[model samples]
Target chain A: MSDRSLSELGEQGLLPLLQAFCPAEQRGDDAAILTPPAGQQLVVSSDVLVEGIHFSEATTPPAAIGWRAAAANLSDLAAMGATPAGITLALALPSDRRLSWLQQIYQGLDRCLKQYDCPLIGGDLSRSPTATLAVTALGWVNPNRVIRRSTAQVGDWIMATGTHGLSRLGLGHLLGEWTLAEPLRDQAIAAHQAPKPRLDVVPLLARSQPAGTVWRVAGMDSSDGLADAVLQICRASQVGAVIEALPLPATTSFDRDRLIQAALYGGEDFELVLCLSPDWAQALLELLGEQAQVIGQITEKPVVQLRLSDRTEILSLDRGFQHFTTH
Target chain B: MSDRSLSELGEQGLLPLLQAFCPAEQRGDDAAILTPPAGQQLVVSSDVLVEGIHFSEATTPPAAIGWRAAAANLSDLAAMGATPAGITLALALPSDRRLSWLQQIYQGLDRCLKQYDCPLIGGDLSRSPTATLAVTALGWVNPNRVIRRSTAQVGDWIMATGTHGLSRLGLGHLLGEWTLAEPLRDQAIAAHQAPKPRLDVVPLLARSQPAGTVWRVAGMDSSDGLADAVLQICRASQVGAVIEALPLPATTSFDRDRLIQAALYGGEDFELVLCLSPDWAQALLELLGEQAQVIGQITEKPVVQLRLSDRTEILSLDRGFQHFTTH
Candidate 1:
């Protein structure tokens, strides 16, 4: 028993070890008691990352896995224009030596938590044949400031925050299929490993919600892919979209078509695709500078049309990350 | 694509089908907005149930699986005496036809949620090699009304709500090693499949805490078995306890030793182990009647003594449902 594994700790012995990692205020009792601030709606969302399905042990380090898992859930909060308050994690791991792996993962979580001011409320640790991470992040926002995927109005500009296609290129680098020079490789790898959630953009979008602002924001994270996300926004909002061939956001050695393909179909980008009025779009771009890029426009028809530099075409929009379905 | 599997529905296609089951107030947005009522502290907890590890297709049905999964988290809320508000589930499954399986699970969740007024708020669906269900339940409690597992005091009466050992006996029947007749078998199976959380007891305990009352309640659910749960409370509260060989509840044909073992070590009872002043124990007993039973007394020493009719022994307290550790 003295030399027992985490399995031996059996949640009992494991609690003390893990409790040190959680914020002090969130420890004890079966559940944490949160004093949600007045006038703010508590926004909650959960995301799970299963090993082999979401990441490869061969390529992704433990810390990156932890960082990415937390980031994925945080991205959900960002999509809603919510400021993260806390997160509860449910971790399933394989072995005791994985304790070190978990510690690294906690380091990753701590970095994200500290940067975003979200505390690690509490979590459950269990053993599994394969590793899985589930994160439920709680955030706060004015009820009127909530952004939804189902409210993109006709004639609204479709905009994306930050760049797209970097994570795809990063995946390529991880797979040893593409070679990039110097900082580009590091940047690409970072994008894939620890993509930043657009928490900073929430306040800017929130600013547009006071009294009688003309801007209406409808959005979600572009995790599956750009085209698929556009299709989802259109389907949810009961509108269509016309996506122009936007310039590729990452420095890549791939040809134009490959870069375009990555931008349209490469998943794990973690960028926000938003719909807003054109005037607000201009105002947002001026505020966010180059971080906000207008990529398309919402239309009344329920179709997704991709306009290339030299050709106009409608895409089937069938390729995005769907669980159980193999690409 | 029309004939595509859940993997093809990817999270996007599957959302609408599952969305219909969740409350309309909790749908649409990336994150659900919850307005925590004034003067109440938000209480939240999460639990995970993995297939094969926690249940098997040979023994448990999908609805039971769903029911048990939600029940497990709700039990945590019940342990804290919190009234459930909403729940967010993250489900990982294997196939497309399992949509029916999922619907059954949702039916189970709906049954529990409806009974407690806890709405199905939001969730994430993903594909997995094996099925996994993670539920995060949110509730609310008066800040002063919160109970803890670590506050048991010396000379306090150790009590239990509801019966013991039925779930374990039911598990035995489920494994085909045992059999029960008629209503008892059904009751035992229900105990295993959908053991009720003691939400009804919270108000009773809260009723005791109105200024200068001698009663102080310290409690937690006995999901891990009586001995293990006792040991846990004893350790956290830094007190010992003397558990009597109490009369077993539920009609069973098992011999005395077997019945005694089941009562002492059977896990998943979902009953609560509480500590309170002796006088309040009588008050609570009068209030709850047979639902509340005095099983032991907290002692000053740091040891657990189990007293039989003619013999007394120290308990090793090794048995419990521990994750990762094999039975």
Candidate 2:
């Protein structure tokens, strides 16, 4: 196919190309027609990824940019323990960009959409000085089984799903600050580009406990780093936390301090940091296998204390990424 | 209060302020949980407006910026004949913009959300090189009653709800290309900044017809100019149109040619253009009072022809504001 500017494709010409990427169930005119199955509540969340802020063109390909944006929003639904249904993307691109670039981006987007079984329903396109993508992913969950960040109790065990700090490691490799050979470097880069949401575990997590028992699991996606996410749960639930001195999952080969720093302060990991009742911890661990790890425990005191591996120091760390403060 | 940057407010610091503006029904963790009432299908649409593309910072205020973005998306729901349920805003702004300015934007957003009974459910905020807003509005409609752009039939009366060229006139006034005194200028400017979505008319339009009767009504919001909207409907329906030189609702005080050109070519009007059955047209006209007018009719041939007022000339025009082209 010949290269064409998005302006050349125009809005009218672009619709078919976009629609081709969508599943047949959601190709409506103005809005997608969705019927949430009976006994389910619709769950909706939105996230925007700007060109310079979220991904720099110098280090990222267009397709990966799209995949990363989709992953971020899908992860929000994953945190709620909801099944992904559909997503709408609103994109702004500089007119100078070729339509081929958009197609490649959509290819990445389609990879995630297909993996999650979420269709692209509708979107709007506009001109911008820099490329920006805003995506809204909709999902469904039983009304009674929804998870919230504010429900972690003082005695709950903190568990993280999937490897933490991998994305940050990938960034290091991309920037040439560090180097890893073959498969390891590729794994790091893939982790950064297409971090999968733990949608498979949501159903298991949302499964009801015994009839009279109080439900135990509460969590959110660790997009803002593990430390920040734990702090958020504490702030919302009016509790505190104590991070155990255990080695983090998937950090054996890396420098200890750097990986720990990335696990604590680096953002965009897209893993779930969950608080579960101590009784259910073993069951969750068995269910998640090597993907889950017990990182810490909730505390009664209103402070976050990290228990050092050296066995003597219990230091209070407040170094998680905060949007306004760091910028 | 001191002037605080968005970074200063931070995502966490701004949540309470943002929550203060949202309706009570939709404040939740992770994603808003919405239960669509029985028998209604959930409808969703998203639109993004970027700085310098949709509106420049020089002439438009921050509040208007927020309001316009919401209006545009809400209008999409209106076109779908959906009752507004909720909206999620994804915002990206330079760190230097004041929190107060952001607050004002929310104020404008609040105005529309409250007016339509659509709550602000959730949002994401991040730093960007340019100020940009992307809004996703959700609504509901009877599954069988969705009015699609492709459903327009030949011999349908092409009806337009509300004024056509007012927003373009407003733009001219903003650029100081023309002068209007007092309320006329203000009215034009309001049309540009806060083009109200026809939420009130959607229910009336979606009213089901008698059993076994063919319901001949199809519509879409006219955002990309009237001419462009007509072309979209024609292309989708594989039909033709004949626009009559009838007097538009708000063009009495303007020069004929300029107003006509604006009506046909300028965009961001947010008005609904419907193809109605001849019998239903009169009833809709009566119901809508001064806000509705029959501008043309859908034709058998696949061409858009404009009939001149003097009855001596017929013209085919394809001028409309398209992205990437004019920019």
Best by TM-score: 2
**Candidate 1 wrong stretches, greater than 4 Å:** A1-5, A8-10, A208-215, A245-247, A250-252, B1-13, B208-215, B245-247
Give DockQ per model, in order.
0.64, 0.74
Task: Provide the TM-score of chain A alone for each candidate, in the order shown.
Answer: 0.93, 0.93
Can you write out model 2's per-residue Cα lDDT over A1-327, one digit (the tens) per residue? 889988877765786787898766567477888887998999999998888778887667988887887888888998888888889999999887898899988999888888888888888888888788999999998777777888899889999888777788888889788886666678778888888887888876744243466665688888878887787788778899898844354535678788877777776888888888876776778778887888889999978788876543333324665555674
Using DockQ, give the best candidate's number.
2
- Clashing residue pairs, candidate 2? A324-B7
Residue B251 accuracy (lDDT) in model 1: 62
Q: List the residue pairs that clash in candidate 1.
A: A322-B10, A323-B7, A323-B10, A324-B7, A325-B7
Encode model 1's per-residue lDDT on A1-327: one tens digit a residue.
244566655666677778887877677677887888888888899887888888886668888887888888888898888888889988877756445667788888878778888888877877666677888999988776778889899989998987888888888889888776777788778989999998988888755443567446889987878887788788879999999856366554556677777778886788889899887877777888888789989999899999877768776556665675666
Task: Give lDDT per model, in order.
Answer: 0.80, 0.80
TM-score of each: 0.94, 0.94
Worst 10 residues of 1 chain A by lDDT: A206-215
